[model samples]
Target chain A: MKKLINKPEDVLADALKGVAAAHPELRVDHQHRVIYRAEPKADGKVALISGGGSGHEPLHGGFVGPGMLDAACCGEVFTSPTPDQMVGATTVVDRGAGVLHIVKNYTGDVMNFEMAGELVADSGVRVETIVTDDDVAVEDSTWTAGRRGVGVTVLLEKIVGAAAEEGQDLDAVLALSRRVNGQGRSMGMALTSCTVPAAGKPTFELPEDQMEMGVGIHGEPGRHRVPIAGAAEIAERLVEPVLADLQFGGSPGIVMLSGLGGTPLLELYLLFGEVAPLLEKAGVQVVRSLVGNYITSLDMAGASLTVLKADDELVRLWDAPVRTAGLRWGV
Target chain B: MKKLINKPEDVLADALKGVAAAHPELRVDHQHRVIYRAEPKADGKVALISGGGSGHEPLHGGFVGPGMLDAACCGEVFTSPTPDQMVGATTVVDRGAGVLHIVKNYTGDVMNFEMAGELVADSGVRVETIVTDDDVAVEDSTWTAGRRGVGVTVLLEKIVGAAAEEGQDLDAVLALSRRVNGQGRSMGMALTSCTVPAAGKPTFELPEDQMEMGVGIHGEPGRHRVPIAGAAEIAERLVEPVLADLQFGGSPGIVMLSGLGGTPLLELYLLFGEVAPLLEKAGVQVVRSLVGNYITSLDMAGASLTVLKADDELVRLWDAPVRTAGLRWGV
Candidate 1:
């Protein structure tokens, strides 16, 4: 319960205030709880919108800016945003081209975004949905009906957002989003459970010497609990499943090793050091690598790995200039 | 201790391997444990070199890149790097224009860097040193004789690194580093103690209901322990002393709110939402602000704030393009 918050009820609202205060390039709609770029939307450019719970930061909200998300509908911590919030964001960000809703595979998020797309359809905005289910950890989880969408969502947003930003049509952007999602796989482990602000305690109890391998972003039960192993073994457990899930070889792969909130960069780098060699041995030529806390669960000491098979087009798009609170480069 | 490490003794070396694996832009010398820019040293460009205990990540190692430090000498966790490591890095990065050694005010670090500077002098590489002591926490503490150097070192590196990159002579870069250090002030608080890898336990005991105010970076004793308060009150506690120590008004300022490793970004943003207004109310106009984990203790749950008064030139230098693992923007 040791958190830097005034009250559990106000965490999201107050954090949005902080986001607004920290980044002027971002515009926060306090009423709808959606974060948008402050700059005016370009005519006929495809808009990318995504959101889920509030705990995984720098994901949807922090990604809203130039060359990334057009708007992010933020819900309460580990709670789905209301359809009203999503539709409100869709209506505002819709340009002549169309809108793309980058939905994670969580049941609540998928349903809400789907409802919002239907609600926006009457206005003639061609809203397309791309659900990311890239986590190879589980087929079904506590909050998701399929494999949970985890780190690949961060990668998808960057690659597809770049495509959308370059004035690609909605259909092309949707296809690219699907290709990115299909080619990517993720797996996660938790050294500690994340404490939701409202819950005020850790979501689950993990003994001092144990870890939850293949854990979900919302503290969902993983494949199993096991004795905490060294970084090398942990990297093996994460990478083996991801490589088995797909043939990541024969293409330039973009790899991201993200910290789940509480882990330090020193450790993330240490883990990534082990991960890179494993992926290389498996024949995945890592053309680009990101090792840090990009998408994170609140105060969960763990790490997740995402490997995306990329072609030259996707790599080029990822290399494009992006100006967001999270994932800023080449700008 | 629960950390993503193989062995406590090899954490630094393993993490360096990860640093080398993840970032192709920086070259790591495994033997000397120095992270240097992969590109050759620009002819006559003043080189910036910094190092200290390893736990405060992205401080020295993560800042080594094109527009930042020419090299970073990494030490073992919470242990200052040796004189040989510093001298080795100095010899490699020296380009005949002289070198600037950015040292934090810890006794071990100061002494080691001094010896290394003297060792390099016989080799005819002109070396200038700048010691940053911006912590307003205490006049003197366990590891420091004056104020403990804390968050300002990150800001100093960025500003002064840009100066050196743009061909500023050693004297000019040294003077700018001193100016940044003098103008900046920081105060930190810890919700929990960081566990050093070799120690195999939390550095210090902190109760669930209490927090350490004005805490040092290495889990050293702070001013006092206080009942864990609301974010607003905590922001007031951190900001009041920084403002009282200096007049941050009358000039534009660069403010950075860095999370000590364990605190999540959701809370950091919530904390920054509270911190921004207090700085404004105190007449410090925040021209540019960074709200994330820049400098960190291994896994301590807390944050530190650094406010630096900046003029037009400093802001311009701060905005310069820099590419590194920890901080990347405008490139």
Candidate 2:
């Protein structure tokens, strides 16, 4: 219950105000809750847009800028953005090349983004949507019918945003987005449940001596609870499933060890130490590894591993200069 | 305490291993516990070195890279690094141009860095030191003689590091560091106490309905305990003292609303929203503002606000491209 928020009901709006205050480079649509670049890209360029809940910050909203999403629709805590908000963001950011909706595979998000896409089409703008379902945690969790999208969305936005910034057509950008999504796999665990601001308590009760093995970003029950383990063992649980699901050894891999909000970077670094050697043992050639909180579950003390099988093209795009608030490098 | 550590003693080593694994751009000296740039700067460059307790990550360690500290000495959690570690790091990174020790104003840190400077001088390497005492929480707190160096050290490192990268002499860099320290002030509050792994419990008891106002980064008791307030009121508490101590108006400013580890970005942004306008109304022109978990007190749910009065030269240095884990831009 000890969170740095005003009223639970006012979290999103207040945070957006902070976002606007901190990053004057971004234009905050206070009414629709969309974050757009202060200057939209020139005409005849692909525009990228993404969003889900507000809790996984630096994800959809923080990723908006040059070489990333042109705009990000911000929803409420653990809730999808409404079609109206998506449409408003799309209209503001779209150029002649059209807009792409990068929706994570959450039922509420998917359904809403689809409806938004159709609505945008009625406005005479072309829209392509890519649904990313890279989380290997569970097939069906508390909020989704399939694998829940997790960390891959951050990587995909960076790489695909680079493609869009390079004047790639909507088709090419969409193709690259889908490729990165398919090549990336993520697995996460939670030390404690994140208390949704609206909930006023932890989303779920996790015993003091145990952890959720494969928790979702929104506190969805993971595979099961297990007794709390050290960073080394926790690394095994996070990396094993992602490696099993994806063959990362044959190609250069882009890996990320992202904190689930509440975990400090000190511990996240410790987790990466446990996870990296195991990936190397499996013959995974990690060309680029990112360790920090990029995508997060609000105030959840745990870390997640994302392994993206990268070829030269993907690595090149990933290396391109990105100026977003969350992940910025090579610029 | 449910933390991702093998043992309290091993946390620093394990996290350093992870730092090596995740950041190939940086080199790790295991035995001495130092993080240095993988490629040292050419000889005859003013080298910047910083170290403190390991808990406030990305502070001293994460800032080591191209345009920041040449090497960062890593200490145990909440414990200042030993003089031996600092001496060893100084020996390795001391180009002919000498090294600058950026020490925070903690009793242990200041004393140890002073000892290390003398030891480094014994090796015939020129050394300059600057002590940052920007925290306005209390004139004299648990481990500080004056104001505790809370968040201003981060800004000082970046601005002064950039000056060093441009090959500023030790005297010039030292002067700039002093200027930054004099112009900046910070105040922080804690929603809850951080639990040190070694202690296996919260540092202190904080009731669910109260907050520690003006809390130090190391969970040192702030000026007083206050009833929990809204982000607007909390922002006022953090911003008022900083502005009162330093006149930030009439010139460009660099403001950072840094999370104390455990808080999420959503809330940090919300807090920033509440803080920015108040500063503006008070006549502060925040030319650059960074909001995130840059300096943290491991898993402590709170935040600190730093306002550094900057001039044209400092603003230019602040905008320079620097590659470090915590802060980066304008490459």
Candidate 3:
């Protein structure tokens, strides 16, 4: 329950200051809680923007760069960024090419980004958006917000960022992003509940001998809580649901095994070990795989699995070069 | 100091099994501890491969996908993957386009991948390699293995992956990766030390009121340890070294404020708040920025700052679309 922050209310503001000071390249919009590439986009390049609650580090913000997003609005921990913040980001990063807002499927995130997009459009800037609902953990229904966008957001930003970088039209970027969401799925489990600083205690009680399966990134209870089993068993619990939800058997796929913050690489690798054979046995060929803490829940001891079924075009785009702070490739 | 693993020896194997099961698309080379896309690389595509100690999740493994890496070799927790494992991965993923080995600058990781590259080359496979030495925390010299390739490795893999995906020749990919390494720098801090399962205790001790600055990803001692300060002070301590180590002022640059596992997103954002302004005031334009737990140390509670001086081309690539499990964008 102990933390190193000064007055709880001052935590977010103070952290923004630190980010600005630490990296000479970035600028913090303190009044708006927006972290942007200090440099604006090219005169005619469409600007890509995304944002959400603050708890997921290296997410909306980490993805800001040329091949990804131009600006990211950060909200409070587990709370979506306000409309005003999004508006500022959109206005700042907007180029003649318009702006594409990558909104996660969280209720708060969707609401806020939607409002900002509307406002920016009203201001004469063309605003287009694609909401990511890659998490298959929740049942999609008319009554619900739908599945949360867990790990696939990272992939969306990188791939779409590439398209935007190639000077692809806004429609092209949006189409590519939608295609990514259509093909990707994610499911997560939490071995131990995370203690939100504000909550100052475990968000949910998970017995030492048990884990919450199909958990959401924001500490929401999962579909089931089961006895903590071996890595192989846990891997099965996490992956089976995903495979059933999507068919990967007839084609090649890209998979991501992500830690939910607190889980160590030791367990992650063990989980990966358990996952490999089962996948081979399933007759599904994984064309690409990623394992680690990419999308995380603040120090929560758990992991998530994401799979993206790839076609020839998706695979080619996947192999493009990027140069963002969080994901850089091909130099 | 507690974990959910069954037996110490079974950690890696058990985890890999879980990975295989969860990600049906990924094929696990259980015998060799390698994870690859279920589908082999296309003919004439230069295969990209990377691996290292097991604890650094999502590094070599999470990066195995289109636009990043073709295969990742997982070693025992905190231990380097063996030469044989890397050899297996390289041979399997390599196409006639040749294979590019992206090795972090860790002593063991470099040696193992180097050995594998040599072995693959002996078999008549064209191979190119680049060692990322982006950690500014350690001195690069004969006395040491060199700066650990902490956060920058993720950037390297993505950029290189994209280039390889674009079918840029092997030499191009290698050159681009090296360029990224030369332009990027990282420095990290640890608030709490992680207990490597094998070590069975905290890797290093920090008083409850103190934080370790310039800590490496593998629990290596930092440049200094001081009483835990407000997020503002902590951000300064982490970023000052990175700025001092390189010149980020001339052109726009990319910045990543990454958490060393166990640090909550709340703390990370607070740190970012403090970091953003300092950079702006210093006249360094941040063209892109990322904040999150990218490269981590088990559950160590700390963060690192990475700066990549970027140009229009790199920035454009930074915005490219990617579809990996760890990072996805555009769709």
Candidate 4:
């Protein structure tokens, strides 16, 4: 594979080194592969930690900083981190107010985070877990037991992290995280497949003449393969199912057209241009929209759409000042 | 081309519609094809306007907001916007203070912006131009007369835009823009060629076994085609020329590893991880670093590095709170 990497085995470790160098605001635990805020918030404030496979960047690691994730336990490419790593991260980031494990609905990730929570239970730091299953693409994939969590994890971390920053109790942060997860729905399609570093090949074979609809972030199979079509038709196809799956109307909402890693930012905007009008016609009032790569399938060429039905609280928290390597604004 | 676009001709216009829908904080003049800050600063505040072909996104259009740019005129894919469009943008964004035209050093862009400046000069508004030719990849490419203005334009816009937002007169802002351009150097390589919508095919043929070294953002030829190497080797190839060409060592500097559209952020970080130590070994002190897709060729797989030697004044201006769709923090 002609990737910009040295060796498959060294990709995660080398990238973490880059992260430590690029962002001095974050401190990297090289041994455990955890990224923590250099100076975490005050005591009694809820701490947020989320992670998955390493390929979906800026997700868990890049989100660690003020007003977002306090720590991120990174795994190898598409592999969940060990429970020991998660426990180490939880112990390091947790203050008296407890820690929240914001995890995607992956079977391995869910199991590992749960095991880590059990390991940390007697350490005087209460640990609660909120699993995000916002992807409506499939009921379950090879790696996931249920619907996979995709883009909503990024939005949820920001909104819930803001509430945590306001000194909310762990239970309240968990409540807000679950609420955000409940309101968000995401669907993704891939024009091309991503190559896992270890596999040395694309996760799945995608024909040049077609695309995989409802693809997962780990390069998992989508709903089905379909002939390639124009962006407007594709935007309609992606949004129609989302509108049907969720009651996103009757309230101001947040719409995101996130690029699936390989697609250029130019086409992401073009897709959002096509997707926005279709949503409005379907009675969705989009108060805020983010169009870029947030959560991504590594080098998969296409896009995903997430529509979150936002109330005043979610909107306010989303607008709150957040300082992170991935998403930063309003500060 | 399998891009998410309806029609090649409609891509720019359709993307502009999406820009309007995504960022209500920025206003879109559909008739003039310009993106303007929804509400500009007070009278006597200098205005910044930069534009190029549409494929390199978030360069000029996404930078329009409170602190960065007052207006951005967009051209078609890889085609310069006409002098008339630039004139229209200049007339609208210019307060009594003056307007600074930040033009890339492409032949068409420089020529068109010059013509527009002459038009705006007769309209009783002063217009000074700063053309950034920071790319060290090629001396003269097909579209450029000298080194192409690549990623440094983004840095220049932010530093100069902050100066303008602080109500600096046109001359001071012009000086800062030129200074940033002079202190910056950039070089890029593409793993794959970008497909322009109108071309409906890849702009250039790139074999899988090799990469285009020193590739331009518009898919222009690089210094040479080289055998594909690892990220570390590629980083050295891109960074070495930049270091040899300029004195970037012994000072705090801004280093950005920008994706040329198709490369994933994960790979960008991996490349940066490989690039940082070499820079440090060369005695360059990186005070700040930005790793993401800032400037891009349409769906080309590769990355470019831009190093801007920063002084205390430049660092202060860089850290100043600026709000834009592409880069936002400290605001």
Residues forming the 10-long window of minimal summed lDDT in candidate 4 chain A: A38-47
Give lDDT per model, in order.
0.93, 0.90, 0.76, 0.89
- Indicate the docking level reached by candidate 3: acceptable
- Chain A TM per prediction: 0.99, 0.98, 0.94, 0.98
lDDT of 2 by residue, B1-331 (tens): 8998898889999999999988898999999999999984687789999999989988888999878889999889999999999999998898899889999999999999999999888789998999999998899998988889989999999999999998899999999999999999999999989989889899999999999999999899999999999998999999888888876777778999999999999899999999989998888898899899889999999999999988899999998889988877766
Task: List model 3 lDDT by residue over A120-187, tens digit each.
Answer: 88789999989998888777522237777878888878777888877888888888889899988888
Candidate 4 clashes between residue pairs 3 or more apart in a chain or in different chains: A331-B331
Candidate 1 stretches greater than 4 Å from native: none
Which candidate achieves the best lDDT against the true structure?
Answer: 1
Candidates by DockQ, descending order? 1, 2, 4, 3
Which CAPRI level is candidate 4?
Answer: high
TM-scores for all predictions:
0.99, 0.98, 0.66, 0.98
Better of 1 and 2 by DockQ: 1
Global CA lDDT computed for model 2:
0.90
Off by over 4 Å in 2: none
Off by over 4 Å in 4: none
* Candidate 3 interface RMSD, angstroms, 1 decimal: 5.0
In the predicted model 1, the residue pairs found to clash are none
lDDT of 4 at A133: 95
DockQ, prediction 1: 0.89
